[model samples]
Target: MIRIGKSVIVLVLLLLAARPHVYAQATDVVALTPTDDLLTALRIESSLSVFIDSLHHRTVRDIQVMPFSPVGRAVPNAGYTSEQARANPIWLRFRVQNATNKPIPLFVRVNFWCFESLQLFVTQTPEKTSAQTGSEALIRLLPPRVSRAVSTTAVDSLPGLLAASPVVGWRTPVAARPVHNRHFFFPVTVPAGADYTVYLRTLKVRGAQVVPVSLLRQAAYETWMQRDYLFWGGVLMTLLFVSLMSFFFFITTRDPIYWTYLLCVICLIGFMVINNGFLNQFAPSVQFWLPRQNCYFLFPLLLFYSNLVFVRTFLPLKKTPLRWLHRLSAGVLLAGLFCVLMLVVENWVQLSSPVEMAFLRLFTLFYWLPMPVMAAYVVMSLYRRYYRSAAWLYLVAITPFYILNFGQVVANFGLIPTYRPLVNFDIYAATGLFEVLALTFGLAYRYKLMRDNSDRLLSSQREQERTTFATEVQTLAQKNSLLEERERIARDLHDNVGAQLAFMITSLLHIGRQVEQQPIVNGKIQAEQLRTIVGYARDAIRTLRETIWAIQQERFTLAEFEERLNQYVNRYVQQTNGLDVVVEVEGDSGQPLTSAQVLNLFRIVQEALSNVVQHARATEATVRLQTQPNGTFCLTIQDNGQGLNFSPDDADNGERHYGISNMKRRTEELGASFRIYANAGTVVEARREAEMAN
Candidate 1:
């Protein structure tokens, strides 16, 4: 059946080609007649033939001939002669005939030249021959053997030939009239021997035999042409708008997708302009330079590049077979660019054949093949990645453009002839609109990602800060614990050890008093021992008081501390007999010491005093407290009589008492130095470093 249909179409096309002059018979003819018999005698006979061709691919059918003749001809005495016959007025009559089996209601259109002075008079039937005296003709419709004249009156008349120009005469709407089934006629007159031609063109349908079919087809084609121009113009304008926007966006944003889109739109508009003959109408020079071959090459390259950019942005085909496809597209584009450059250099003018042109267009179809696969990949990837509704929306946005563009391609390649009219529809317009919408959606998606990421980062930062703050609080708590422990230890030592020593001192004094009046042999030795023991007790009490003071707060100045120390030492000296003690104060004694350092100094002094009274039975003891220029305090206790000949072995063998060891330990704990040596006498000295004021 397909083969039969194909063969029938081929035969019809051949038949159409065989009859080129068939359209010439459908024009309206005009004849001129004279009013006077003298001018009629000079009348010459002439005939005119005109040809009309259908622009679209169609065969003209059911030819209608409309002829009109003039009412009167020029008279010699009426300021017109034989020389005016060339410019004389003419009128014509119309006739319709049907050669097919079906009846046809004819619509006769009389179009006359403005300068020919032609006029139309429609009657029921036209007369067969010219009448010498009348201004009317008989018209009739005859079926095979029967013919009848309807009237002999004129419907309208003109004075002279119309000015030499095109003119529109009588036109009738396509109305349903009697189906003649055979033939019909109406007639008018024209100037004798005047040369004139008429043009007859079919309306719309190709090879439509029925009159109604032809008329309806003609009206439809006209309407279609009008709509086609409007739709195509609107699409071209829209493409131009998007192209400008894309260009501007590319300029501002420097995004490759915008540039690719701009180029695509430009190519799309070029294809539209060239295909619709707008390029031929407005820029015919450029049209000569461009043809179907160029369109084919340009369209595919633009499409491929645009797809690549979109895929890179929307789909991110950075790996796998998709990546290979992108590379292949790039290679094809480069080859196309090279071809364009060669064409420019070599001035290659036109495509060799329609097949080559078709091949070039076929490349566009090939270019489109990757898009569906790419879109599917994108959809799958985005779905797996959970990109909300963006993936789906993007696919929807892209689908229409894909379909329209590919549909246009199919139409251009004649894959579907019915879709040929849609070839000029702005697929690019639809495509561009969709692309812009898709880009907007993509930006929204990016914005969502950015916002989510920002939120996460802020949450993480808050968590980290909370951890840091908690760590700091823990460290502070630990430090407070250590400080409280130190205070407790200081308080315990002051209360316990200090009370015991005070009680012992009281007991010793009471014993001394009791034994004073007896005058026993060892009474003096006993008194001295009691006194030394009492001195040791006093020193212990002073040391405990200083420790409590150290723990309470900070210490007083060096001058005040020294004065208090001197008074204590003097009281000790007065109580003990057989001892001379001298106290000396030097330098600026007003320098301050820390509470801990003061406590260490007091203990060291107490240890030295005990040592003096217990071990040194010498006659004189000197105590000195001095402040030095180097921000330090020095305390010294020296004995002038009977310096001990202490051996290194004796000190090492534990001969040296714990008083000296304790003093050294206390001084060292306070960040001071303690030394024992003979400096003109046995000297015990402790030195403490002080903080310098800023």
Candidate 2:
């Protein structure tokens, strides 16, 4: 009686479990039906769970299961709240039952794009606990077949294409795959019968992991892929266009800011390519880096640090009170450099992988924390400095990133509803575009400001030069008037005083001869005194003539001065009665002499000549003036004379030093060197170079 009870109980339990499967088959809880020339599939509600296998046994029956809630937050849109689960290897269970008139051969398309090591299982009906084989057994059952490529036309007749079981595999390595239309397709045979359960196991998953599981007809999946590719192609085209334009501006403007901005934009583009799964699509090997979070560390480091430098270059912080901001920006740049080194060591140096990864992750977090703060500070400082337009540009540039990162942060923590379309799009690229445009305009404005400042400075300098020129002209006119007065006095002395002295000397000579003829003693002494007076008058007349000649001219060129020296020497030699004089002018000085220089040079030559004629008592004299190759003017006066008959004591007592003193003083005033020696004769030499224009 006990055995009969056990059998009846078993039959009742089987019937009870079978009832729901029958109802599910009739009501279509999760089945993909072909309609509108596309595959329409619905997921079974609340059938997801995490597979926890604590025991050493790896069999499917030994696996422990927990309920899987993909989204744990309260969703007002869905009118429900679900409990969150920790990141773990998850399992999804779903059933497909065909309630149509014919057998449906449809493939299951699971967008396990963001998952790793996913395994799909199909059975007529899942038992409470069943011993299972490994994934190879399933691979063997659904072997790859030579299936025809799917076309859009085939989607309308999906029922006909669903005859054979579909092959299940991966386009890239399972580890690095992220959801970007990289769906896993599993072909199934769902005839008009009981339901079949499908199992998806994802291992070692992390975060608010989303598994976009769906079922699709093969033709419909292909059509969807074409559309997806087209959309991404458009995005790529836009990025390329913007990048090219940035470089073009950089080339034209020659600004480092534009180049840095361009690099930041390109890095952003690269990041989107990696994040959106396009890089993995092309090179599946990149999946290895995803496990290490290199995608998070590398590209963002480039973009963020490049932006920092770009901001520094854009702002006028170097000479401003807010220059400290530039230093902080530099510190951020150094930190970024350190992060780059850490990433390189982690990825390529083959170090202790865990430690390297930890360093990279920590640095990445720290780096981003200061970035927005720095940007905000830059904007506020610019505004404070009255760079309002630049501040507006900065605000525009950073707004999109602010929205994106903030929204992503809140959504990841389940603080807000995750808006997939907004979060998934490359908002950084959009922000980068705006920033590049705004900065380009700002740079243009800066250039204009520089140009205006330069023009103003030039005008001020020209005005200053004009004022100086006017002052110099007035001073020169006053100097010329003073010189004219001196010339007038010299002419009066030469014409009147000079003639009177000559006439007095002649009258004294005549009276002396007449007194000598009469022979009276007192008269003889008086006549002797008169003859001495006549001699003194003739000496005075010679001195007066020289003074008059010197004060006559306003200027004397080197050639004219040499001519005057020759004429004076010839006249003095004639008066000396047998003194032979040689005057030679040699070489040409292309530069002209100023009035002061000419006066000083002429006076120096005059003193040398007077000393030779009056005191040297030389029978032969030569005055040679020449210009050296280096523009030095040299004058030498030599005479075969009773050379300076004076001792060192005589010079110290200021005896016979008048002419030497005058020559030295004039030479010093002209910035020339003077030398005198009593060798063959009292030789005097003066050397000078032309002065440069003021």
Candidate 3:
């Protein structure tokens, strides 16, 4: 292989040295070898075609005799140095020979889309000089007297329903470019052993001026097109799926972020549809008359605005000092809106030289630079926050998108020189696919975050409700207790104090009557009655004082209960002469009791002491209080006296039974057990268990 390469280079050098002009021109020619004997399909670099400067709109007759240079490689920089050169058509020249015994069909393809026109002319070289090789052979190649021309049209026009719709941005008309595909293809047939030179003139209205052409056999062209169709079909279907899926999410979630992302995806989808020529192939009348050039500009601007809105919706920036970023984003959105208006004007004005007008359009269009700048700023800001929030998803998802586009932009602006034959690579497909998929994941993550937050909020509300319910129950219980206490107080004041006062009033009236009857009365009965009246008044006053004290107290512990019991017993023993009482408290526990419990228990103790003092007829009595560890308690009162045996449920046994009944009722009301042992000495015991706490 090395020796062959060396020999070929030496032969080319010798040929160039012997006949520089002929060999150089001959290098551009494509030889048609027999297809069967060929070991592999040949790869022809489209850049090898001869380039002729045809700025003046030259006809085929005029172009055939034109001179060309080998250095005029990539047509984009093929001396587009002046307005006149930019205005003219690009002319590509190729020479092909059919070495097979039969006529062979050859296809010349321009792989780029949206060029306005292409024309191919085939002129046969004289057979007499076909085998000649030198300046003489090269000279004979010019001034073709017989020729055939092929047009850019690939299909014929149809009437009525099959006609292209009259709209704003449809592709080159079906009549103008009968080929329904994006790329231009021209087919030509060369006779056996015949040599011919072909010229292709392509006219582009705007954008890049690169003209790339390929030569292919009939089988190769069909196979290439079949593969191309399958790839494009799959791409379009996938984009459609993404667009529909995004739209569905926006509809169901009603989320502004989803809506924003949907708009972005829609723009990208539209850009792909128009740029790939599907709009030219498959719509009603197969038309795509929209402002194709401006749409290319408009879609990117819309995408930028949507992306900004998407970021803003998810970030918690409103309360921060960086809230100014919101206004900055709005400014970028406004710039996008303004660029849209510029595009609208371009479409409406439809200028002759759109490339010149598009220069300013492009300048204003990139004012959206702030959109990506804002994205970078937000990413850094969120990173500085240590990725604590869901905003990090946006950064992770779109990073690859910007990275890929940045490289595309650099290459698009020609920051790096084109060093070899340029191949068309679909950067749009790569970046757009990655971006949408990553963004979809980001949105899903955000949704999960939202659901979690909602769950926490609901749980908090439920806990608050439980607390409020417990408080309400406690309050109701307190109110009920207060009403019950008021009723008890009413009964005590009426039954005890009122009855004592009545008896005192009666006694005084009787004494006064006896005194009136006797004139100067000093009777023993009268003196005793007066003394009895005074005792009744004193007893009533003491009863009122004790009732007031109990009512004023809110709560009591077991220790306080013991103290109060001791005081009551001491006072009672003083009032009743010849009576001895001892109060004993064991285990001075701080066990808490409700106000109602304390009042009832204290009153029970008072009733027991009164029974001993008035009825027991004994000199000694004892009150004992004890508390257990299980939040339960016991209290006992007993005396050394003549014990009377009776049951509280038995028929009423006069005034004596009333006090006993009261003590039993009070103990039962407090959820405690009461027992009286009628033996040598009376014993009353009360036991209470723990109450459930709120």
Candidate 4:
């Protein structure tokens, strides 16, 4: 199938390169009716015989004698179908008669840029007689013309001519004026009462050999040129303005779509100007220097690349669930690769030798592949409702180009005859204008969507923050209420129980004094007992006061607890003059202590000290509070005296046993380990992890 397709493509190219298929086209013969001004006539041959002429370097005089087909007669509003012409030198035979009484100077204008060389030949008597028999004389139209033209390369160079730069006063006074016109002009003066046959011939290395001919007198031709210039100039200016505005938008917003859009517009403008033959006039340097394939492929390639990129940015495929967008991007890339490949092959064939089969096959593939891929993407976009409004607008914008270019491509495949309107009018430009405009609006719409999404996200974030703040405020209020309640409880305990304890301690001291004054033996013993009770009552009041202080503070730090413990120990030692007490604190004592931890720790210390003073009969006792680096809090109380003779299992009656049991119970309540043993005197130790204290 592939081989068959290749053969078919080659045959089609051959047919197009050979000549228009000689078939009878019933075209009306219109006379060039002259007026005072130049006469406008579209008397062109419908069917033209193509002869491959290689006398490219020959002058007009030499080409005049060259044989050309004698069959063409100019008919009004007639054109050779675009498919029937190929990119090669071809001579078109057509006749134009001066149908007026006076002599008229006729001008011919060929309007397209594919023709690299064009010349005119006019004769009163054609080589053939009848129009019907002239069709039979289409063979052997030309033999290769070999001519030696004089060369001027041997001229001697002057001193200044060979210099790298021109001398200050040596340059010629030549004014540089840029030409602004399209269409190759040829003039012929025909005598009245004459039928002049004209042969129009041209050569090219690329593009279709389409010749759009029009006959005009001098005044009318000038008027046409003026009008054409004005129209194209206005169009170019509008595109330039659009490009500037797009650039401005790009600069201000830093949006890549605007930059791409501006470039696409500029390329579109250049495509119009170049393909319409305006570049030959405006930029002769580019026309002469740039390769034909480069010029031909540039604008279309840029159009496809920029347009696809813009569309991708406008409606990103990654954001959608649709899978075909990947295929679309791949298709676009493939199309571009094929286009470059085809151009390379064409340029290689021109520079070296013709490989007609590969050239036609690759060219056909390049031209035909992009259309379906683009069409599929557009259809899918519409069906999926992707960028729905923009999709519809894009559909409407590209419709004309698709319709026109499809016909042209089909004609190239020899599937249908070439459509005349596609050759004469540029529907691509018309559709492209709308496409760019729609895309501009689409870019704006896309920006709006992004902004809306950003705004919504910002709003949601702010609302979440507000909710978090409100929750935090409520939590703080609850904490404050709890703190106030704790303070009130501490105050109540201080006012009632503390006052009653103070009164009991005072009354006991008074009773001790009164009993001492009695002076009887039993009375002295009673007074001593009263004094001991008073000492016990005073210790109880101090403990109560410490408990109250711990309760009042929201947080009791270990440092503050240690300070209170030292004061209590000092008070106990001071109450007994015979005993000396030592309090040593080690490590960090600034760790925070909870209320339960503070109360239990204080009670344990008080019990240990009271046991030392009342039962140990020791002269000196030491209290050590140490905090380890691993957050271990240890309390140790040791006395230098005769130790208690109590077993660890004795939990029944002795004061020593009761004291040990009470300290052990307090240590257990604090989640600490408790141990008591005699080492020199007696030592009581409690250990707890600081975090567990909380």
**Which 10 residues in a row give candidate 3 its minimum summed lDDT?**
158-167
The RMSD (Cα, Å) of candidate 3 is 10.6
TM-scores of all predicted structures: 0.35, 0.47, 0.70, 0.52
Assess the local accuracy of residue 86 in candidate 4 as a C-alpha lDDT between 0 and 100: 38
Model 3, 1-694: lDDT tens digits are 3343346345434433432122243334577777542322334443255554445456554555666544223333332222223545667766677777989876666664555555565555434234422322111111121222222231111110001111111244433443345665566777798787666666554444556566666667656777777766666677677768767766766778777777777877766666555555555242323353445445556666667766676574656677676677777777767667665665576545556455454544464475465565556565557333454455555554554444334333544322222234244565567667767766766667766877898898898898899889888988887889898887777667888999998888887777777775456777777788888898899787777877887867778777877776667564556568787877746877666677777777777878888888878888887776565667788889988676656514677578777777777776777778766788888888777210
**What is the Cα-based lDDT of residue 439 in candidate 1?**
56
Candidate 1 lDDT over residue span 1-694, tens digit each: 3343346345534533432122223333332222322211122111222122222221111112322222122100111112211222222222222223433222222211111111122222223323333433222112211222223232122111111111211111112112111111112222233332222222211010111001111223345446657776777777787677767666755667667656666766765565434543444355336332243234445555555555555555456445665566456556555545533432554434554444434443455555655555555555466432545555555555555554444433333321212332344555555655565545545546656887899899999899989888877865674475365445436443655576676777777676776656667777676776766676566556656665575547777767767666766654655467777878766667665566667666766766777777767888887777675667788987556544322333453554565666666665567678875668887777665311
In angstroms, give how far residue 285 of model 2 lies from its true place.
5.8
Better-scoring candidate (TM-score), 3 or 4? 3
Tens-digit lDDT string for candidate 2 (234-301): 66776677678768767866767767767866877776676556665566566566434355346756
Separate clash counts for every candidate: 35, 5, 9, 0
Worst 10 residues of 2 by lDDT: 73-82
Q: What global local distance difference test value does model 3 have?
A: 0.60
Find the candidate with the highest TM-score and give its number. 3
Q: Which candidate tops lDDT? A: 3
